[model samples]
Target: MTEATATRTDAQATAPAKQTKKVHLIIERQDNPNSQPYTEEFLVDYVPGMNVIACLMAIQRNPVNKDGKPVAPVAWEMNCLEEVCGACMMVINGKPRQACSAIVDKLQQPIRLKPARTFPVVRDLVVDRSRMFEALKKIKAWIPIDGTYDLGPGPRMPERDRQWAYELSRCFTCGACVEACPNVNERSSYIGPFAISQARLFNAHPTGAMHREERLEALMGEGGIHECGNSQNCVQVCPKGIPLTTSIAAMNRQVTYYALGSWLKK
Candidate 1:
């Protein structure tokens, strides 16, 4: 064998090993709803196809800080890791999103995760979304169905309307839109964009239309559709890309007509 060829083989064999990649995370944590929140940093080994949730799980297993101190396991909520349940929703890198679907590779370094401040914080990354649920209740966002008896096939809706309704129904009450909106805050009792969209969704339904007048009446009250600032932030941050602004617009028209009809009756 040639001496030059042997020398090249030895050089290739002695090459330095590839360095392991890591994901750096900065998480805002609150011990309880009333406790002061603080920041903690963690380093997690990077794995191919890993997501934000995966990074969190790694921290859970190690429970160590970037300073090498053993600490409490970072608490966060997650379910249906496919991004359907929305339980894993949090402020990721200043944008509200589902951690289960946030790919680690795509996010910028020093990824940040925080609880959505739109709702009361429960702990770490979990927040109380009851405000949205209460809004849904006030709007009567449901179709009145009779007893569980067999009522086969209610009225049918046109294909066009059904398609759009399906889009509005995609809201899982993740509170992303609420977090993005500037109007939703402690001082404001606004029912929020999702409730307005939900009101529109039910008002257009074949069976839900039965309560359409009632729904409109609820919206005409305080914290109804009038509270929206038209900031358009809700649609921009909505992960599902639901037509939130469009729904709010449609409900505005409905409320106007309802108000006019009531005035005429007086």
Candidate 2:
């Protein structure tokens, strides 16, 4: 072979190979509410832009562990893969975040997935968020528009206030704030930060402010704003960056005013 031809052939033969990799995942699993918890390891071929949810789906396709033993496919809740639904919240490497947004490339090797411990673990990486929902119910976190009729723009808010209110409206109830909060646990009745921010959202609205007294009263009750430890963990972990601490502080002032007013009324 000619020297130039041989050089070209060698280059073709020894071209750099694509670096394909398989991500390893260690999932904490529980078959049922009453079943004992266990760890299951899985290996999935890497694909560009793959998230943790995609890895779980890969394992679901073939229910086998790292040891190659057949096992039940892991169960999880996911909706709106864009992280808007907050249904796929889980503890990824000890940080609470939505699995849909947890890209494999950004994650550390041997990614660890677990259920958020702030709520009851129903199954693998799926916890019952009913407690937080119940807290919302307890506070009646909605504007009451009585009688089904077109009120036709009942009220309007100032542009500046509306801008701040819009920030509070971004909460998806993903539970990352709750999971990061130390006050939310089995023993404490703290309602968590999301609800407090929500209270602020509605209260800032001109029409919603009619029931501000009721909302403030609810915050004064058990599992209310007083339960907040002010550790500020909720703000740090909130994926939406909803300014939770500000809401908490605002509600704190409201609750204090309510208490003083009630005392003076007596």
Candidate 3:
């Protein structure tokens, strides 16, 4: 064969490989809360800059599986695709993260998607994150006020303190930190790192400080800061980089101080 023809032949041989691009996903699906969980494999045409949410959307549009059979489209929750909502938290390839931010290009082949098992699975990828919210309530994660009449402006925080509090406030109740934490499993009632961080946030507020001792006491109770195993998985998996371990440590100190003070008074 001529050298030019040989080069053309080589190009022809390689063209098919380059032309065919696919994103493989193995998603864990649960039909209902009482049903057994199973896996479903999917293949989608690879697209540039595609995130897991995008891939799921494609699958939703097609509703076909790897076996060339029609199947129910996978279910998931998502909002604020920009990663602020944290509604799309799931275990992608064994790491809990936001599906909207998990770029396909950054993930390995046959990417595994599972519901954040720390919470009860509502469906395929949707989990009932109410537990985390309940934990928040347990710690009184909000400032209280009597709404009968308008209250004047509340106390202001220092600029430096405000900046850090802003960081803690970034938590959108996404369960990534809780999902990554081993102590936050079914048998454990550990409130997780986000609650401790939130307590820190509220405790810093001059008005919120009125309930600070109550929050501290809550943290000192069961499923509180003492339950943290110091695995540090929470800090690593947090999509917002919220310095969870730092919050946990700070809360630990605050709880200790409060307990000592209470004991002295008694």
Given candidate 2, what's the lDDT at residue 201? 88
Q: Supply the TM-score for candidate 3.
A: 0.94
Model 2, span 96-158: residue lDDT tens: 999999999999989999999788889888899998788788777888888688777678789
Worst 10 residues of 3 by lDDT: 12-21
Residue-level lDDT of model 1, residues 1-266, one tens digit each, is 69999998887787656356789999999999899999999999999999999999999999999999999898888989997888999999999999998999899989999999888999999899988888899989998787779888889998999999999999999989999999988888888898999999998899999899889988988788898999999999988999999999999998898899889999
Candidate 2 wrongly placed segments (more than 4 Å): 1-20, 148-152
Which one wins on TM-score?
3
Quick one: ranking by TM-score, best first? 3, 1, 2
Give model 1's TM-score versus the native structure.
0.91
Better of 1 and 3 by TM-score: 3
Candidate 3 deviant stretches above 4 angstroms: 1-20
Predicted structure 1: clash tally: 0
Error of 1 at 33 (Å): 1.1
What TM-score, computed on C-alpha atoms, does each candidate reach? 0.91, 0.91, 0.94
Each candidate's lDDT (Cα)?
0.92, 0.90, 0.93
